[model samples]
Target: MVTPSTQEKARLGGRADVGAASVAGAEYSTIEHALSDALAAHGITGLAIRADGGIHRFDSADKPKGNRNGWYVCPTLEVAVYGFWHTGEQHTITTGGKADPAAAAETRLAYQRAREQREAERRAQQARTAEQARRWWAAAGAADPNHPYLTKKRLAPYGLRQRDTMLLVPLFHDGELVNLERIYPHGAKKALFGGRAKGVASLVGSLASADRVLVAEGWATAAALHEAMGVPVVVARNADNLEPVARRLRQRLPDDVTITIAADDDRFTEGNPGATKARLAALAIGAKVLMPTFCPGCARCTDFADVALCRKERVA
Candidate 1:
């Protein structure tokens, strides 16, 4: 009796084991089989290829997560099964079908043209969005103290405006309004789609005469912290923008000015993005970090504002 090694089986592209069963260690003979096995191992069962070089997760396709495939790979339009699932790691094996050089050249040219067109369209759209944001800023009145989100958060609107039941928060980049985030009565929040989102922030207080400043995520948190700490809090809006906003602030602010990253303590979520990003932003600038102090036996609170409000309620 003869037995094939795992690497040998992979090279042969012949399935040593096939089924819905555990073939994680088992090797496959063909590129299709190996690719299929890789995806199946990651829980992508159906593997439906869509019309736009996209691989669906199951028999019926839904919106791809991360706004990108992020899961499967497609080397060519004709040879999709040649691709393998990348696990955000350095892929070692290179068994996928080779794309035709000439065909790839044409695709590159087409992609360039499409990218340019999209860029032009995006610029135009941003201009339109900026104009709309300016108009809304002018037309809307000051945010009401009785607004649902404001009341629930127990924070007054710094410079926000009311549009019907939604509170409009203007987001700026380089002193120019680029986008707006609307807070609904139900606490749902959304930024204007297609508008520039990165590195933009909504200010809660004046930066004038400020030697040390606090930076945080979310408008309510920043507002609450500014009230409690008596320092200007720059709302970085989200975790991903922390680094960019911090770098920009470092460049723009004075050498003597201190920037403290008041990161949200995202204890519920995996990876603790809020605190991790805060530390990264502070580390990049050689600044300080002010984490939220959750009270003893606190279970749900994950931010400075939440903790502050809890303390206030307890006092009352």
Candidate 2:
């Protein structure tokens, strides 16, 4: 019996000991001719025939398996049909199954359009935030030439140069700077508990005269509340820091003072550390926890300032 070498066995779809070239050759020729005719009718190009009775339009690195060794097809244009060869028989595996070129083009266009829209929105948001920050500084007396927080040149002093710098979000009462709380960016090395304003008995002392006081988590939220309620506001640098501020308020203010902890709905959701802090603070002080409805696209209504603005927009 004639034995086939490794190369010859691969050519005949057999083990090294088997000589199946004669059977393969007889069956493959008829199938190959029919497949070529079909490919021509479909306007496919770059056609190449393989020794193992397969046809392919593209170069593939993967080794063909089983009966597929002699059958391969790829579309040269947007779509292409595939044909299978079974011994002397020819079978069209797929026809009129080409991918839509227009659809692929539309996908790319849609991605580009989305990217542009996001970029535009980001720029607009930054502009609006910067304007809001400017207005806040002006309202808090930081923009005044004689203000202690302002430099001799009339600019606000840039604080701590280190990575973990504290930002003071000031709460104003009747145009007077009454309370200030320190805050650091998220994931900073510093602790979440912030320092209170100098010479102030408590953060709540600023709102003593007001019938209702709004408490919030951040400076932005405090600003939002001030805009919304037109009442006195106090900002907690972070949610966890609310307890000390609340404790101070209880000691300084009259027993009848109505303090509202502006809670964010996000706290009720599981695994929100900030919300957890707010809840604990409210419970300790016996303060009313007011959770405002969040805006549709807003991340969370954690801060009074954010809630105030978001709520107004929703109502409008």
Q: What is the C-alpha lDDT of each candidate?
A: 0.67, 0.43
Per-residue lDDT over 1-316 for candidate 1, one digit per residue giving the tens place of the 0 to 100 score: 0121222112212122111112444443443544454555444455543424433323212335533322333333322222122222111121222323343343333333433444676689788888888888889999999998888888888888998988999999998998899999988988886788789988888899999888899988998998887889888899889888989999999999889999999999999999999999999999989998887889989998898788888888
Best candidate, TM-score: 1
Local distance difference test, candidate 1: 0.67
Candidate number achieving the greatest lDDT relative to the actual structure: 1
**Tens-digit per-residue lDDT, 74-178, candidate 2:** 222211123222332122211122224442343233333433443565466545544444454454432222333222112222221121234444443334444
For model 1, the stretches where C-alpha displacement exceeds 4 angstroms are: 1-99
| lDDT measured at residue 73 in model 2 versus the true structure, 0 to 100 | 28
Which whole-number lDDT from 0 to 100 does residue 197 have in model 2?
29
lDDT assessment of candidate 2: 0.43
Lowest-sum lDDT 10-residue window in model 1: 12-21
Clashes of each: 3, 4
